[model samples]
Target: MDTSDVAETLDHLVADATDHHYSPYTRFDWVDELDEQQWWMTPDLLSVAGTRHARELDEKQLMRLSKWEAVNFFSLNIHGIRELLIEVTRRIHTPGFELPSEFFHRFLGEENGHMWFFAQFCLRYGDKIYPDKSLPVTTTEEDTDVAHFLVFARILVFEELVDHFNLRMGRDATLHPLIREVNQVHHDDEWRHIIMGRKLVGLLYEPLRERGDQDLRDRLDLYLRRYITASVQSLYNPSVYRDAGIAEPFAFREELLKDPARTAYHETFFKRITGFLSSQEIISGSPFEGSRV
Candidate 1:
């Protein structure tokens, strides 16, 4: 695209993002405390193991599982936002992307504030936050711009996965109002982020595909598969299982991976991600195209 076109696109995106700004403190009725007994933690929003295996537990066990999953999901959000903020800050003032960069600067600030509030909830109730154990991998080994582009693409994919849940839970009036508001506000911002991510990935892909970089393309496909698998597996939090008195957490995770119910749940969560990857032709000739959802 020409400079003028890029400038105009960036301006529109910034305006859209700016118009969605919401007050985190007043958006929800935070004054209403949630009771463990009254809190009806929806199984669909819980992690795979927590939801699937929750039927075997009693009331206290269920509550523990629900709280743990909530903590885990929000903790992941905190870490993910932190990483994205760093990337946004690095590019915000850089040349060529000044227009988009200005909006992203606001995004970074908002996400930073989100991290603080999420951390506060975890610390205040759980007494601590879970540590991030997921290992970061380079999108490709190639020493080219495609590698960097793929990194951002993978980040976008992850954001989409989170946004899927956020969009659903955000407006769910059935859940606690505070939880719903948090999700609602987050989904509003993330909708713009996802759109920007899609555009950025498309722009990055066009040139790389034009150059016919087979190795880079192959690596991108592999990275996408790895990310999907890792994200699904992340739903099995050992701490949650341990806290709920489940025996041999790692062994349980391995077993759960083989369960039909668990596998189906993972497929559901990854349906959109896989579809998008395929539509982008990133996995056109790959085995995943024929794999079961």
Candidate 2:
């Protein structure tokens, strides 16, 4: 968290970003349509996976659900990228952000490209992108450093969660080739983002930690834990279920969210991010530990 150390990391990240940049428009060969018969997402990554609910669906119905889940996943990326872009934009070139602003330019461009491709996939294949339904994180912290720390912490958590899906789906051969390609591309970009976010979040929190603001830390931890929970919950959209032709969409969603198997999946999925937050002393433990919905 030294000033020189932060500057050096940003320098290397900025260089990497510059050397690896690509045009999103020409990056992939778009087919007229994605095959409806193939899995758009890995079966194990689906919302209903690991539960009795998955047993009720026939293969064709499960494939249909996968398609909607894939769409929902891309839509979530679009919305998440937009939120992080806004937060980063507010900080770039501003006071206290001088060190990371150069990399922020690269971050902004890459994220915008990401939003474009994710939207393209959702629109061309699914006919519509799902709307963002999760509420924004609201905080009572009046300290500038606290506010800044929260912004980067939220960004880090978001990227880590998205990368969980990206890393798995990108390598999953059961998914369609285009699905794999998109995920692979995203996974590649997200590594840089995640690394940068972690470094920045740690640096941002250092000042607060030095002040021994245990009360403030506790409050921030609660806010971020709820944010993580809300983020995961957004995937269980009733609209997604309805679009998949599932009966009693709301009731089905409610049941699935409370399922023990689903809770286990959530814990496994969230392990890395929660561990990282705990390492930073940002949170005492995993939010999904013994958590329901």
The best candidate by lDDT is 2
Candidate 2, residues 153-206, lDDT tens digits: the string is 888888888899999999999988889999999999899988888888889888
Cα lDDT tens digits, model 1, 73-128, are 77888878887876667666666445567767767767776787778667765666
Please give the clash total of every predicted structure, in order: 0, 0
Among the numbered candidates, top TM-score falls to: 2
What's model 2's TM-score?
A: 0.97
Off by over 4 Å in 2: none
| lDDT accuracy of residue 76 in candidate 2 | 94
**Mind sharing the TM-score for model 1?**
0.86
